[model samples]
Target: MPMPHILGADHVVVTVRDLDASAAAWAKLGFTVSPRGTHSPHLGTGNYTIMFQDDYLELLGVLTPTDQNKPTQDFLAAREGIERTAFTTDSAAGGAAELKKRGLEPLGPVHFGRPVDLPGGGTGEAKFNVFRWPLLENPGGMRIFACEHLSRHTVWIPELMVHANGAKAIARIEILTADPKAAAEHMSRLIDEPAIADGAVWKVPSGGRRADFVFLDAAAFAARYPDAVRAGATTSGAAALVLVTDDLAKAKAIPGAVTTGSAVSIPASAANGVVVSFVAR
Candidate 1:
C-alpha cells in the first residue's frame, strides 16, 4: 500500500496568554494579522492568525479555562511561545491510519470549527479535522499535529498575505531538543520526510510546502538562540521561526531586529517568546 500523503506545514501555533496583545505584537513585527476569531464555546479558546500563501502563523490563547483549553492554558502558564506545529493533510482519517501503521497511534481525527469574521463584516465558518501525534507531551514545548482544511476559502485570505516587513514565506522551524537524532527521527516520521544529517544538526528539507525543520541540541540551540532558552524553552520543542524575506534591508529595519551575521533575529521578548529570524532571499 502507498503511504498517505503528508502535505507540508499548514500553520504553527503560538500559544499566548492574551490574544489581543499577541496580535498587536505581531502587527508591530510587520505581519498582517487577521482579526480575532473565537472557537466554539466548548473549546474555550480564541486566536488571531497571520495568513501566508501556503502556510500561516496562529496566536492561540484560552478564552475560558475549560477542559478543552486546559492543556493550552497550562502551556501558557509555564511559557508562552510556539506551542504546536501543524502539518497539512488532505485526509485526517487516512493520515491517522498511516500513523498507526508506522507505530504511532494518533489521538484524533477531531472535528472542530470556528467562526471567521469575513472581510466585508460577514460571518463564515472554518472547519477542520485534526490528528495529533504527541512526540513530546510536556508543557512549554512543541506538539505535532495534522490539520485537514475543510473550507480553505474561509481561512486563506489574499488580503492578509501582505506584510510590511517583506516576509514572503515561512522558511524553516527551529526545534531545540536534548537529542537531535531522536527529535529529527520523530519529525521525519511526523512530516513524512527523511532527515538529512547536517554535521551536528539535522534538517528536513522543504518539501512542497517550501518550509523545513531544523533540529539542534540544547547547547547548540542556546548558542544560536540564547533568548529562546532563557524564555523557559530549555526542554524539547519548537523554538524559533526562520522567515524568508525578499529584502534584507527591509527586514533589518523592523524594530527589535538584532543583526547576527547575515540573518536578523527578532528575540523572543518581542515575539510572544518565540524567536523569529529573517533571512534575506
Candidate 2:
C-alpha cells in the first residue's frame, strides 16, 4: 500500500492568554503579525498570524466563554505555549481515512471559515477543512491535525511575508516527552512515515521539505537546551520552534535574543510564553 502524504508543518498553534499581548511580543522579535481575527461563533477563539512562505505560526486565544472556547481555555490553563502542530494535506477527509486505517480514529473534515481583512479595506472568507483525533494525550505532548485549505487568499499575504528578523521558514519543531520511543511511534503512525531513531531523540520527517519534528525525553531535552526548560516551558510537551533566518546578526539584534552556539533563542517571557530559536542558514 502507498503511504499517505503528510505535508510537513502547516502551522504551529501557540495558545496564549492575550492575543494582542502575544502579537506584540512576536512583533518585538521582528515578525510581521497579521491583524487579529475571530473564528466562527461556534469556535469562540481569536488569533493573530505570522505568515511564512509555505507555513505560518498562529497565536490563538479564547474569545468568548462558550463550549467552543473551552479547549483553548483549557490549553491556556494548562500551559500557554506551543500546543499544536498542524500538518497540511491535499485532502483532509482522505487523511482522516488513512489515519483510521492505522488504528487512529480521526474526527472530521470539519468545515469552517473565517473573515479575513483584505489589504484594500474589505473582508474576504478563508475556508478550511480540518481532521483531528480526540484520543491523543499530551504529557510531553502535541496535537496532530491535518488541514485542507479551501481558500488560499485568507493566508499568504505578500505584505505579511516581510519580517525584520529575516526569518523565512521553520527549520525544526522540538517536542520534549517522557518517552522518546513512544512519541516516535505515535508520530510515525500519524504521518505514515517511519521514525528514525537518533541516539536519545527521534526524528519524524514532516514531509515538509524544509522541516522535521524532533522528540526528546526530558533529560535529553534539558541537556540540549537547559535554558528553555529553565524558562518555565512545560517539561513534557511541544517545546521550541527553530526558525531559519538569512541574517543571524540581524536576528540576534532582536530584543531578548540569546545566542547559544550557532542559534539564537528568544525566551518564553518575551515570546508570550513560547521559546523560539533562530538559526541563520
Candidate 3:
C-alpha cells in the first residue's frame, strides 16, 4: 500500500469575541475577504469570514444577538484564549488509511462543505473529504476541522506561497506557551512530527519543501522578542500572531491600540504590531 502524504500548514484560526470589530481590524493586515460570509448559527462556524491564501488567518468569534436565537455552548460566547490549528487535505481516504495502518487515532472523518455557482450559470461545491483531530461528536478544545476544496480557485494563497519556486521564507511558525515541551509533543504526535522533549518547545517540519513548526514557551518567546508580553494581551487559550511588516507608522495610524494601551513596547524593529483582536489578548 502506498503511504499517504502529509500536507503543509493550512490556516491558523483565532477565536475572537466580536465579529464586526475583528473583521474590520484584520483587514489592515492585508486580508481582502470574500463576499460570502456568515456567523455560524449552530456551531459558531457561521460567525466568521475567511481570507484566501497559502496560509490564511481566520477571524472567528461569537454570533450576534440575532444569531443567538438558538443556544449553543460552542459559539454563544468566545472562549478567552483557546487557539485552534485548522488543516485541509485533498485525500481524506488516503490519509485515514495511513493513520489507521499506523494505529493512530483521529477525532473524525466528518464532511462539511458548501457549493458556489460558477460564473457561466452552473454550480460547484467545495467538498470536505477530510478528518478532524477532535471529531464533531466531541468538538473539544477550540474546534478543529479539515476542508477539501472540490474545485480549485485561481487565487490560492497558501498553495502559491508554499510552492513558490524562489524564496524559502517562513522557516517555521513559533508557537509560544507555558509548557513548551508538552505543546511541542502533543502537536508533534497529532501531526506525526518529532517531540520537542523540553519545557513546551518543539519543532515540526513541513516535510522537505515546507516550513517547519517551532513551539516555544512564553518566556522564551518574550526573550526572543521583548515586545510581546508587554502588549497587554490577556486571553486564555490563544496566541499572538505578530506578523512582520515594513510600515510601522502606517499601522500606528490605526486608532484602537493607541487608545486602549494594548500595545506598549513597540521594539523599534518589531515593525508595526497589532494586538490580534480575534484572540481577545
Per candidate, the number of residue pairs that clash is 0, 4, 21
* TM-score for all models, in order of appearance: 0.90, 0.93, 0.62
Q: List the residue pairs that clash in candidate 2.
A: 8-206, 140-236, 140-237, 141-237
- What is residue 28's positional error in candidate 2, in angstroms? 0.7
The local lDDT score (0 to 100) that residue 59 gets in candidate 3 is 54
Give per-residue CA lDDT, model 1, range 24-109, as digits (tens).
98999988998888887877888999887789899999988898667787777778888887888899999899888877778888
Candidate 3 C-alpha error for residue 248, in Å:
8.1
Candidate 3 lDDT at 154 equals 23
- Candidate that beats the other on lDDT, 2 or 3, i.e. the better one: 2
lDDT of 3 by residue, 1-281 (tens): 11244566566555555556656544543345433344333333533334333455555554444432222335335333425555556676666656676676654555545444344555555444556554332211233445455545522423323211122222344555566566555666556656645433566554443445566666755554445333544322234443322333443554333212332223211211223321111
Per-candidate Cα lDDT values, in order, are: 0.80, 0.80, 0.44
Candidate 2 per-residue lDDT over residues 11-83, each given as its tens digit: 8899888789889989989999998888888778888989888889999888887875576677788778888
Clashing pairs in 1: none
Q: Of the candidates shown, which would achieve the greatest TM-score relative to the real structure? A: 2
